[model samples]
Target: MIVVLIGYMASGKSTLGRILAKKLNYDFLDLDDYIEEKEQLLVSDIFKSKGEIYFRKVETLYLKMLLENNTKLVLSLGGGTPCYSDNMNFIRNTVKAKSIYLKASIPTLVSRLKTEKSKRPLIAHLETDELLTEFIGKHLFERSQFYNLSEVTITTDNKTEEAIIEELVLKLF
Candidate 1:
């Protein structure tokens, strides 16, 4: 089975995916990291040098490649991965692939993303928590439609990683 973890930034997709993959004894692959390794450039660099259109095209290409080629895998996707191209549709239709949305409340996301702004290119420009909160609110609102298409939706607000993983395991099995 291919377990695909989807959610907004700082919503614990990568962190939980690593742990979930271990528990399930599945191989783990983070799509952004995979892209970086394959392209020999950072995602941020890709966005800066080639622009978003080019990045999205390659992103879709790799997503298809990974989904088609892997099994017994836990794939962690970028926050925006599903929103662009027919990526979500492809995941939904893929056999043996289960898409899970790690939903986190706006406040939860704001708090988590506060300290990690520098690491995230998308939210790095906001100068204040209020701005960050507002940005996340609007961005998540826009993205939630795509996210809600997941086979399973796990709300991670105020939940420990262990608890979230426990719930995920139960739901997936």
Candidate 2:
């Protein structure tokens, strides 16, 4: 079975994926990191040099390849993975993949993202707190429908990584 964790940036997908994979004794694949390795470039670089359209094409290719090589694995997908192209539908239909959405409040997301802005590509240029909050709110609202399609939705507000993982494990099995 494949476990795909999807959420907005700073929603703890990678961290929770790692913990969940460990708990299940399955391998873990971070979709962004996998893309970076395959493309031999940082995701930020891809966005800067070729633009989002090109990068998402590459993302789709890599996503398909990963699914082909499937074993029992936990995958942490990018924030926009499900929102773009046919990626969400592909995941839903491909394997015994169970989708999990990590839901975080706007304020919680803003606080978490502020410190790690340098790492994420899409929201890196968002400077002011007000602007960042508003931007995230708009994006989150727009993407909520795709996110709500997940088989399990877990709220991550004010929860430690371990607690979230525990909740996810229970919900998943």
Candidate 3:
């Protein structure tokens, strides 16, 4: 089985994916990191040099490639991966692939992202917690529709990583 983790930035997709992979003895592949390794460039660099349209195209391509080739794997996707293209539909329809949405409250997302904004290109330019909160609220509202389409929806708000993982394990099995 393939486990795909989808959520907004700082929603713990990568971290949970790593832990879940270790627990399940599955290969862990972060889609952004995979793209970076394959393209020999940072996602930020891809956005800066080639623009979002190009980046989205490559992202979709790699997503399809990985879904086609991998099994017994844990895949953590970029926050916007599902919102663009028909990626969410593809993920949902793909056999043996399970997509789990890590649903976080806007406040939870804002609190986590405020400190780590520099590491995330999309939210890096957002200054001040208020601005970040506002942006997350609106962005999350827009993205939630796509996110809610996942096979499983796990709320991460106020939950420890271990707790979240535990719940996910119960759900998956």
Candidate 4:
């Protein structure tokens, strides 16, 4: 079985996914990391050089390849992964992957991301809180439909990673 974690930036998808995979004895793959490995480039570099269109195409390709491998894995996707091209349907239909969206309010997201701004490619350059809020708002709006398509949705506002994963494991397994 494959579990796919989806959500907005700083929503704890990767951290919770790693913990869930460890407890469940499943392989863990962060989609961005996989793409970086496959392309021999950082995600930031990919965005700078190839543009989001190209990066997304590569993302789709990697996702299909991962599904074909058919291993028990937990995949943590980029914030925008599900919003593009048949990606959401591909995960749901082809792999029959359990999709989970870790939802968070804009305030929570902005607060969490403030500390890690240097690590995120998309939001790193936005210096002001207002700019960050606007960016997240646009992205959340664009991707909400796909995010909402998940079989399970967990709100992460003020919740600990351990608690979120515990709840997720119960619902998914």
Selected candidate, larger TM-score, 1 vs 2:
1
The superposed Cα distance between candidate 1 and the true structure at residue 10, in angstroms, equals 0.5
Q: Which ten residues in a row have the lowest lDDT in candidate 3?
A: 115-124
Ranking by lDDT: 1, 3, 2, 4
Alpha-carbon RMSD, each predicted model = 0.6, 1.2, 0.8, 1.2
Segments in model 3 whose C-alpha atoms lie over 4 Å from true places: none
lDDT of 1: 0.95
- How would you encode candidate 4's per-residue C-alpha lDDT over 50-165 as one tens digit per residue? 99899999999998888768668999999989988899998888655888999999999999898788898778899999999888888889899999999899998988888888
Clash list (residue pairs), candidate 4: none
Question: 1-173, model 3: which lDDT tens digit per residue?
Answer: 99999999889999999999999999999999999999999999999999999999999999999999989999999999999999999999899899999998988888888888888878889989999999999999999999999999999998888899999999999
> For candidate 2, what is the lDDT?
0.90
- The residue-by-residue lDDT of candidate 2 on 65-97, one tens digit each, is 777778799999998889888888888887678
lDDT of 1 by residue, 20-126 (tens): 99999999999999999998999999999999999999999999999999889999999999999989999999988999999999899989999989998898899
Candidate 1 stretches with Cα past 4 Å from truth are: none
Better of 1 and 3 by TM-score: 1
**Alpha carbon deviation, residue 92, candidate 1 (Å):** 0.3
lDDT of 3 at 57: 98
140 in model 1: Cα distance from truth in Å? 0.5
Pairing residues by index, what is the TM-score of model 1? 0.98
